[model samples]
Target chain A: MAENQGVLVYLEHREGKLLPIALEGLGAGRRLADTLGQRLSCVAIGSNIAQLASQAIAAGADRVYLMDSPELADYQPDIYLALMGQLVAEARPQVIIMGHTDTGREIAPRLAFRFGTVAVTDCVELNIDNTSGRLLATKPVYGGNALAVFSTDTDPQVVTVRTKAMAPAVPNASRQGEVITPAYKVEPSVVRARIVRRVLAESAGVKLEDAAVVVAGGRGIGGAEGFKQLEDLARLLKGAIGASRPPCDSGWISDTAQVGLTGKIIAPELYIAVAISGSSQHMSGCSGARTIVAINKDREANIFRHARFGVVGDWKKVLPAFTAKVKELLAS
Target chain B: MNIIVCVKQVIDPEAPPSSFRIDPATNRAEMRGANPVIDPYGEYAVEAALRLKDAGGAKVTVISLGSNLLREVVKKPLAMGADELILLEDAAYDGGDSYSTALALAAAIKKIGQYDLILCGREASDTNAGQVGAGVAEILSLPCVTLAKRLEAGAGNLVVERVTSAGYDVVEVGLPAVITISNEIGEPRYPTVKGIMAAKKKEPLVWKPTDLGLDASRLGSAGRKVKLLRLYQPVYEGRCEFVEGQTPEEAGANLAIKLREAKVI
Candidate 1:
């Protein structure tokens, strides 16, 4: 590894608050830096983002590159990429790590192209090869049917680590890192697209992607109304309502609530799959969940193989009891 | 105006789950002959571009970065009324992550300059990175609008409805921009028989890295910054206890009992 080249992590923030995944990226990058025997630096860009820079340092960054610009207050791809591209060119890091969140997903690839390098995305695992002195990345493929390993003998490797793939770092409050406030030049003419408004769904709290617990229903739930009981269970448990593709395609649930390869990838602590057959496509997204409980009337449903616990019964019959019990526990 | 729609051929998402596989040696998906479908998201992209082209009287070009299978995939967009096709084909292009692919695509776009707009799917069904479109936009130094659910032509600009967590945001961007269409935009139109016949007679412009003035070292695995180390199936290790009951109320009670025991309720 080059001396000047270190692991540069992009700190993800929104509306002045730092995203948890950004700290996780800092932790993951710190490990990569340690393995490579290099320093770790982080970059935070957005308007009024100076306060969050310290958090990056606390997470493990040796230095923080700050770029505060009004154009970057919201996520406009052109301005963000331009700012990042400029930073990368100046820093010339061997590896640039980012969180696989909405902002990171949008910026990482764009930055990679501008720097003329490939970016491995949604990586679940990462390691450094001591002998080869190269970084190795792993991600799911074929709708989670297989895992593919890849490596490159090149410089400035770009990677977007998936959320929950690595543990978040313990902040070192005493450690104060160097902060470099970079000069940002953004032309209003360059920002052709503007975010005039942002609308959030009413049930946004239970978004499958960020949920800690997900109660999913499938075709076996019978119809659209079937989701009511599942939603009740989810609400009782303070979890999200998820659905298999069958229900999403059948218009029983919105696509946003679908949990599968084609939809959201979730890693909830507790995943309750009701009447789901456990198709590989669907399994790919929920594979990361810590504990899986499957309920189906058909004892032979494919979901049983991957589920940690399964009840051979109708979800309609099983869900009310589960909800009541959960409510009771919470009440206590 | 010229518009290019990037299309990718993917395994039919509706196909049975048992058909998917990966070729270990090649590090490629073993989906050679299974039913091929236009990536569902890409369909929205193609349709969006076609709408733009028809509205603005622009020449729409369909581009694909893949094998000969692209011949079929590209034709679908052409049949939907794309005027021309460009195929970036080469063995070296395989195993390319989003950034590398975007680099080659940017080079191709520069070679085929004069395009006023570029459209892509928000994310492909396979990798689902949703990065390439933004990557291309970055490489080309162009503005990009992501998750555009609705679009209309405006005076020297494009009015788009961008989806966000809250609701929809209406934004306007001038020409020479990249827009990623969401699946909710609309269903992709079916190719008419006449359009398909016309598409059969059209030959795509095939180009390698060399053709687009890109160095071999900067276009493939060699140029990749990140690598995949390993992929393993996650192990599910939870013990499940069945709650037996003959009636709905009894089943509910049994489930309630189990939840109470687990202290999850």
Candidate 2:
């Protein structure tokens, strides 16, 4: 539509490492491009991103567009929006796939509105409409209580896929692709907001994203001290610790550890939900786990509905015994 | 200084999963017994505005758009100390997507004619699209900040601790910008008895599409650019296998043993 040619994905990176969700975006773009018989391209914008270009190629990009500059180190919404805007004018892609990330959330809608279009965000699934050749995006609404499929008729349809919703493409070192360095022409003055300071929460031991097992708690944990017991179980399994919104809001745990639709979306090998009621929002995050186990006092707690194995008992009485038995099982 | 905070009334997000239901024909979520509430996320935005009002003599005006909105529900902002309440409630306002929603809100803001800052939730608990605030800013041609944990308003500029994927960034922008508040702002203050009494006596100002001078084509569902093809609830396979023993302590041990046997640990 409107002389648009191919599918373009926004390759987002942080701390010199490409975000996994960006690669997932590529996987989704590759499929749609292949179906439409159009080339799939990705744009990597940031400083010192030469290494990212090759990775993007391996991850299924037919062409990699780069906007590398020292000034592009940190994400300024206006600057990035302008850069992408210029690229859209030049490349004329039919679709733009981006992560539902901090940058994408700001840029997708703004970019769509700039081009007199609309962006369907936090999409869990995407496809091409057979008759109209329009992009169809399926996103979760009402905190995962419902799912809605949306479509737009405008060219260069924009969408931000939910983080970790799609599996990434298999990377091949031998895959051939071309790298193009586009002229970065956004004026520095366009950025009205300036970053004064940056602070990252200190995470201990295993990161939540990479953890094989996750030990999460809820309001039933009662206090910060209860998390210490959960921590013991997590440590024994070489896993990470997570919690429901209450623990995070109650100051029992850092906000980063909160698991829900709005919080971190994790899919671990084994997810042990202790003293958690397992609301739908919480289930949206960890439902993808291979095997879910629940330890809660209430027999009717919602967590049990999703758990593969469950025990109905107070965490205080059950966790210590559970920990001891696990300690002995591991030793043997 | 004048400030506007945009809020929404929606099906309670914290409603028990059992009561949640989807109307297949309408492709919408309805509750069998749950009542609607001010979006949990928007409460933080209201809290952000009230805090600004607490610090200075600024007047905080709250704007909400929807159909069949409850008075006691939408007026919660006033009960929490906002100075004014405006509602764009009409059947025509129903079935709109984020784009149309932002169009009407921006039009209403223009009609009000005076504002130094705009505030909204990072996302509504119901839609969770998180686009309306940014869309409003883009339409109004103003700088916007999304997912701000905390904010401090200065003389001509406001400093906000905006949430990023990695952590957080402190950003400073000129006044007359939009800020989308995150839950990290801390718990919103409950409406006091005095505040609730004050809210009951003060009637809110109501404005429909005609009131804002927007044509029918540019209002509500008619103005939507993105079309919803289908809305449905996902089915879950709940087949939990319970591992138990005679006693609670024994059940705990049995669970661990069961996991080890299944090679799950």
Candidate number with greatest TM-score: 2
**Which stretches of model 2 miss by more than 4 angstroms?**
A14-17
- lDDT by residue (A67-139, candidate 2, tens digit) is 9989888778889998999999889999999998778887898898878777988888988888988888998
Candidate 1 lDDT tens digits, B1-265: 6788887877775554555555556545545457677787888888888777777677888778865564666578888888888888887776666767888888888988888889999888777678789888878878888878888887778888876533467878888889988866766889999999999999888998789888878666655555655544444443456667787557766766665566544
Q: Quote each prediction's TM-score.
A: 0.84, 0.97
Q: Give one digit per residue, the lDDT tens place, for model 1 in A1-332.
A: 33448999988887776687887888888899999888899998888888887777778889999988665778676677778888887888988888876567667776776666667777777788779878888876656666666677656788888777777777998887899987667766656787666666566556677778899999898888998888887887788999887786577877668676546778898898999988777887797887788888877666777776667876776777767766776787
Task: DockQ each candidate and list the results.
Answer: 0.44, 0.77
Work out candidate 1's RMSD over C-alphas.
3.9
DockQ category of candidate 2? medium
Error of 1 at A261 (Å): 5.1
After superposing candidate 1 on the true structure, give the runs of residues whose Cα lies further than 4 Å from its correct spot: A1-4, A14-17, A69-72, A204-212, A219-224, A244-265, A279-281, A296-302, A312-332, B31-33, B50-59, B70-74, B78-100, B103-114, B165-169, B190-256
